[model samples]
Structures are given as C-alpha cells and as structure tokens.
Target: MHDVVIAGGGPVGLFLAGELALSGCSVLILERDRDLTSPLKALPFGMRGLNAGSAETFHRRGLLEAMLEASGADRKEVGADPDASEAPAPRDVSHFAGMGLDAGGIDASALPFRLPGPAMAGFMTSLEAVSTVLTRWAASLGVEIVRGAPVTAVTQDAGGVTATAGGQEHRGRWLVGCDGGRSAVRELVGFDFVGTDPLFTGYVAKVTFADPRQLPLGFNLTPTGMYLRTSFEGHLGMNDFDGGTFDRSQPLTREHLQAVLRRISGTDVTLTDVELASSFTDRAMQATRYRKGRVLLAGDAAHIHSPLGGQGLNLGIGDAVNLGWKLAATVHGTAPEGLLDTYTDERHPIGAAVLDWSRAQVATMKPGPNAPALRKLVLDLLSTPGGVTHVYRQTSGLFHRYDLGGEQPLIGLSAPDFRFQEGARLGELLRQGRGVLLDFGRDRALQTAAEGWAGRIHYAAGPVRNDLGFTALLIRPDGIVAWADDHADTEAFQRAATRWLGHPRTWAPQVGSGRVE
Candidate 1:
C-alpha cells in the first residue's frame, strides 16, 4: 500500500504528492480527468495571479523559476534584487470588488520582518502553467498518477484507508481529497459541508464578439451587475445577480451567455462564436472539519469560495504545503503526538477568513441601492496608505501568522530568506524538504544539540547579511519559523525542536536485529 493516496491530480494534489515523495513517502494521485490539457486551463481563461506567499512557497521548493517561465512572466517583474541589503516596497496589490488599490499607497514600514528576496512580488500565471510545473515535479519524485480515476467511495479503519476510484480499490495508510469544490471524497467520507449560498452566478468565456466596442476594456460596474472585458480578444467575464438561479450543470449556450452579458453590461454585445466557457458561483462552503478518521481534505474539497480576489488556488497551495510534511512524518512514524491534527487547527481559521473575504466582495458588488454607496466607501478606505496596507496584509498571503503560541512576532510566520556570508540562503537550504536550524552565533552547544534530529533537521551555522536581531532560528520543513531567539539558547532550541520535529534520536536500532546497541 502506498503511504498516501490522494484523490485529484490538480496543482494542489500534485504539489502535496511532491512534498510527500520528497519526504520519502509513497504517494499516488487519482485524477478524474483523462487529459490534463484543457482550453479552459490555458491562456486568458486560466490566467491566475500568484501572490507573494505562493511565490515564496514555490521559491522554497526551487520551482519558482520554472513557474515564471511557464507563465511567460519576466523574472524582474516578480522578484527583488538578490544582492540587495534591504527589502523593497510592495509593487503589487489586489483589487476589491472592481476597485484597484495602488501599490504605492501600501505602507512598507507596517510590514515587519521582511528582507530582500526573489519572491517579493506577485505575478500572473495560468492554471495550466502551475499544473504543468507541479505535475512534472511530482513525477520526478516518483509519485504515481492515475488519470481518469475519479474517486467514487472511501472507507477508513484503524490501519489504513481504501478508496474506490475508477471501479478499483486502492489502499493507503492515509487519504486526502484534493479534488475541486464538488468533491466526491468529501461526500463519500461523510464530511459535513457548510457555508453561505452564492449570491450570483459568474461566467468566463472565450468568444468572437461581433460588436467588440460595445464593452470597453477593464472592469465595468453597472447598476444591475458587473462585467469585465480584457485586452485579449473575445475574452469576457460577467457576474449576473440573478439570485444565482442559473443552472450551472446545463450547457453554457451562447444565447444564455449573450443574454447575461447584455443584461450585466447594459449593452447588446453579440457573441458570434464561443470557443470555450465555464461557470462558477459565489456559493461559499467549507467542510466543518478537514479530517475524518484516516481520510482528509484540502484545497476546494475542504473549503470553497468565489473566484473573487483570486484566493482559491493560492489558498489550496497553502493547505498542501502546510499539511504535506506533517502528514508524511505521521506516516513515517516520526511525527510527534498531535502533529497531524495541527493541519486543520491552523488552516481552518484561515479558510474561514478567506470565505468571509469573498463574501465581503460579493456584498460590495451585489445589485442594490446600497451597493454603490458601500463600494464608494470601501474604495475611499482602500485608497489610504493604512487602508491599502491592511488590504495588502490580508490578501498578499505573505503576512499570515499561524497561532503557534509564541510571544515573538517572527514565530509562526514564513521565514525571511537570510543570505549567508557564503552566498547561501535559507530558501535554498529548505529545498531538501527538511527543517532548518540556522545558527548565526555558531554556538557549539546548539550545533551539538541539533544533532539529535540530524536526518529530520539540517543545522547550518554562518554569518548572514542581516540577522534581524536574532542569533538563531528554527524553521519547519514548510519554511515556517517554528522558533526564533535573540541568542543561542540550546535548551530552548531543543524544546522547540522537539515540539515540532519530535523527540531527538541519539542512536538507531540495528536493521534486522530490531535492537539498539
């Protein structure tokens, strides 16, 4: 049996598979679709923006460059100078309802513990680009992917989980559902899904516009609804506040799309041909708990919201990285007690916050006498330096602080990429999928203490360009700072390490002998 059998082979599933495989766990991905390539996942329709947090995640995995290349984004546009001594100002910011925020208005002084790194800015990438890069990476790490195998059922017991997919049963020590919003594994596993219903039905289509000039480029908010026309020819999006009454399962006929667009845009825009189209709703929902016995859920399977603010994909990536290593350690018999449970504990709140964020956007865009006033007020607030900075913190994905019960500000935050005097970086050290113990003081006692968890944690001692007032730091495999110290405290380090990486092993038992010397 494989250590993990994941349902869905999308970006989140593939990324989780790679993380597990990197930690030496056997992983298998069951994908519902026979083909990975789809017109909907390419170019204009699939264009997605990767926030700084997601970019940093990719950088730690050493996949950032490939992702940029796949997305055809200039490296300089998405990253900061490598040799810079200080962090740079924010150059990118997310929008609210249709109102854009100025990156210049973001107060850089408010964001703490930042340093010059390659992934400081967010960039645009397509879903196909992200999927391609992750799929190749997962395959290289020996993850078995079985396409056209949709998960039909799941059963779990004390020993393992058995998932029925494509009429075949696959066994694994654990199971995770990385499937999209309408997830089969979640339903089969009896996870209680709950949330607010959608307020509107949204559409994205690639069509031939007979009267292209009818709708102008950029976001257009009308008294009734909102519609967007991009620079890409015939690429269109519309949000119709028809109480979300549109049947999404039915075919997206050109007539229906034309009617929606005309009504929302208040212009008789003609669609001669529709090359591709898809529909989604702001029907935000989330599983009450991410896990049930041996079965677990991540990404849209666990929680789903509207595509507003473009948080769905990035949120799933966060879930994958956060859960991957903890689940792997649990399967490998090296995880401390309660390690696996932290996945939901830490992620559930974040998921809830994203849902609310989506709901807020919908509220601001809903067709009503109050919507315009609300939108104007929000825009005014978002225009200020403090207001824009708040928005930046909320959406940037870089400022999230997991509740790790720490007094220090840096704890539970993504580690800053500290450059060593030797030109090495904290991000590079994390590429091996192991915890990093950085000792700026080079304390012999701390180094000796870290040896107890040698294979699980890598110890590196050096003088960095900037230490940020810390002499040492313990970063988890996922690149989260588990502990930070102003000085090298060996006992504190050991305790913190044990809390995350488990108790130290001073010796190993002889193979076949089953006994320690």
Candidate 2:
C-alpha cells in the first residue's frame, strides 16, 4: 500500500506529496482533470499573491529559487543610488480591499520578530506557474500522479484507507482530500462543512470590448457594484451584489458577462469576444475537523473562502506544509502520541481567521450606503502608520502564531531567517526537511540533549548576527518554533524535543571535542 493517496493534483496536493516523498514516504495523487493547463490558471485570472509564509516554505524546500528563475523573477532591477544622479527604484506595494499602501508607510522596523533577509514579504505569481513547478518537483521526488482520476468514495478504519476513483480502487495507509472547494472526498467522508454563504458573485474574464474607452481604467467602485480593468488586453473583473443570483453551475457566456459589466460599471460596454471567463463567490466554509480516523483533509478540502486579498492560495499551501511532516512521521512510525492531532489544532484556527478576513472584505465591498461609509473609514485607517503595518502583517501572513502555550513569544511563531557567523542561513539549514535545534551559544548540554534524535532533528551551533532576543530555538520541520529561550534550559529543551520530534529512538554519547553527536 502507498503511504498516502491524495485526491487532487493541484498545488497543495503536489506540495504535500513532495513533502511526504522527501521524508521517504510513498505518495499517489489522483487528479480529476486530465488537462492540467487551463487559461483560468494563467495571468490576470490566475494571478495569486504568495505571502511570507508560503514564500518561506518554498525557500526552505529549495524550490523558491527555481520557481523565481523559471518565471524570470530573480533578475530584479537594482535601485539606483539616490545620492548619485539616478532615480531610486520604485517601492513594492500591497493592498487592503483594493486600497493600496506603499512600502514607505509600512514600518518594517516595528515588526521586531521578522528576521533580516532578502526574502520578500509578498510577490505576484500565477497559479499555473506554481502548479507547474510543484508538479515537476513532486515527480522528481518520486510521487506518482494519476490524472483524470476523480475520487468517488473513501472508506477508512484504524488500519488504513481505501479510495474508489475512476472505477478503480486504491489503498493507502492514509488518505488526504486536496480537491477543490467542491470536494468529493469531503462529501463521502461526511465532514461537517460549516460556514456563511455568499453575498455576491464575482466574475473574472478576458474579453475584447467593442468600445474600450467607454469603461474607465483601473478599479471603479459604483453605487451598485465594483469593477476592475487591468492594463492587460481585455482583462476585467466585476462584482455583482445580487445575493449571488448568477448560476455558477452553468458555463459563463459572453452575454452574461456583458450584462454584469454594464450593471457593475454603469457603462454601455459591449463585449465582442470572451476569451475566458470564470465566476467565484465569497461563500466561506471550513471542515469542523481536519482529520477523521485514517483519513485527512488539506487545502481547499479543509477550508475555503473568497479570493479577496489573495489569501486562499497561501492558506492552502500553509496547510499542506504544516500537515506534510506530521503525517509523514505518523506513517513512518516515528510520531509521538497526539502528533498527528496537532495538525488540526494548529491549522484550524488559521483557516477560520482567513474566512473571517474574507468576510470582512466582502462586507466592506457590499453595495449599500453603510458599506461606502465603512469603506471610507477603512481607507482612512489604512492611510495611517499603525493601520498599514497591522494590515500588512496580517495579510502577508507574517503575524500568524500558533498558541503552543509557551510564555516565550517566539514559541509557535515562524523562525526568523537568521544569518549565522559560519555563513549559513537558517532557510538553507531547513532544505533537508528535518527539525533543527539552533543553539547560538553552542552549549554542550543542548547538543547532548539532541543526540538521541539525531536523524529526526539536526542540531546546529553558531553565532547569529541578530539573535532576535532568543539564544536558542527549536524549529520544527515547517520552520515553526516549538520552543525558544533567551538562555539554554536543557530540561525544557529535552521536553520540547520529545513533544515535537518524539522521544529519542536511540541514545548516543557525545564524541570527544566535536559539538554535535
């Protein structure tokens, strides 16, 4: 039997498969669509923002560089020296409910926990590019991906899971549903998907306009609805607040899109051709539990929300990364008691928060007098320093912290990308997909404590340029801090290691003079 049978070969499934395979677990991905390439996943419609968490996850896996290189995103133009005769480079900007905030207003210094690095807080990318990169990487790691195989049913007991897909049966020690929001595995598993419905139907399309000048350029917020026209040829988006009257089940037509454009933009814009069109709603939902017996849910199958702020893709990727290592450990028979359960405990709240974030955006964008006033208030707040920083931190996924029940603030937060004196970067250390016990002081006791978990945990001793108020940190496979302290506490360190990496399988004595065992 395979270690994991994942439903859906999208980015999330492929990412999780790569993670599992990196840890030497067998993974099989069953995708419903035979053709992976679709216009919906291309530019304009397919554009997705990669937040800090998602970007860092890729960096740790050594995939971010490849993706950036492939997309020609690595060759960024260097800013001209202001002291010289050249103009400074343009600053990067982020948005809140379509309200833009420049890099100047955001005070990165206020974020004391963020590590100094060249890694971006956020960047624009397309779903097609991300999926393409992940598919290749997963395959390289020996993951088997089967397309045109839709999962119809799933049966699970304490021993394993059996999935029926494309008139064939597949068995695995565990099953994960990474399918889209309309997840068949979720339905068959009887998961309690609970949440609010949509307030409007959103449309994204690429079309040729009969009279392009009739529509205004950029975003237009009207009394009835909102619309956006991009610089790209015939790329437009509209939000029709008709209590989601548009039928998403049917294929989108040119006539329907023209109607939506006219109503939302309040313009007599005629569409000559609709090259591509897709509709989405702000309907938010989340599975009550991420796991049921030997079956699990990740990505869109676990939670779904409006694409506002482009948080959906990042949230799904975070779920995959967080669940990957824990699930692999469970399947490898190296997990501690309750290790797998922590996946839901840590990720469920994040999903709920994203849903609420989406709801807040939709509420402000609703067509009403009150919504306009609220939008004005929000815009005013975003113009301020505190508001800009807070929103940036939240939307960029930099402020996400799991409640690991530790007094230390660093605990349960993403580890800063520390630059050590030995020229090793923290992100580089994580490329091996193993937990790390980073000791800045190079304490012998800490090294000795980590000796038993050598293979599962990598112990490193180095002096970092910036300590970020922590002398030591125990970073999990996903780069989350399971424990941190200003000073080394051997007993506490051992306890945290046991809790996260599990009790040492074999104890080994420290070798002479060498720091690590």
**What TM-score does each of the candidates earn?**
0.97, 0.93
Q: What is the lDDT of residue 324 in candidate 2?
A: 92
Which tens-of-lDDT digit does each residue in 188-238 have in candidate 2? 999999999888888888999999998877777788888888888899888
The regions of model 2 sitting more than 4 angstroms off are 74-93, 249-251, 506-517
Residue 2 of model 1, lDDT score: 98
Which candidate gets the maximum TM-score versus the true structure? Answer: 1
Model 2 residue 469 distance off true place after TM-score fit, in angstroms = 3.2
Error of 1 at 162 (Å): 0.7
Tens-digit lDDT string for candidate 1 (1-517):
9999999999899999988988888899999999999888898999888999999999888898889889888989777887789999999899988888899999999999999988998899999999999888887777899999999888889999999999999999999999989999998988999999888989998999998988888988898899998888888999988767784767899999998888888877789998888888899999999999999999999999989899999999999999999998898788899999999999999999999999999999998888888899999998999999999999999989999987999999999999899998898888878899999989999999999997788899989999999999999999999999999989989889999988896422111110111
Query: How good is model 2 by TM-score?
Result: 0.93
Structure candidate 2, residue pairs in collision: none
RMSD of every prediction: 4.1, 4.9
Estimate every model's Cα lDDT from 0 to 1. Answer: 0.90, 0.82
For candidate 1, what is the lDDT? Answer: 0.90
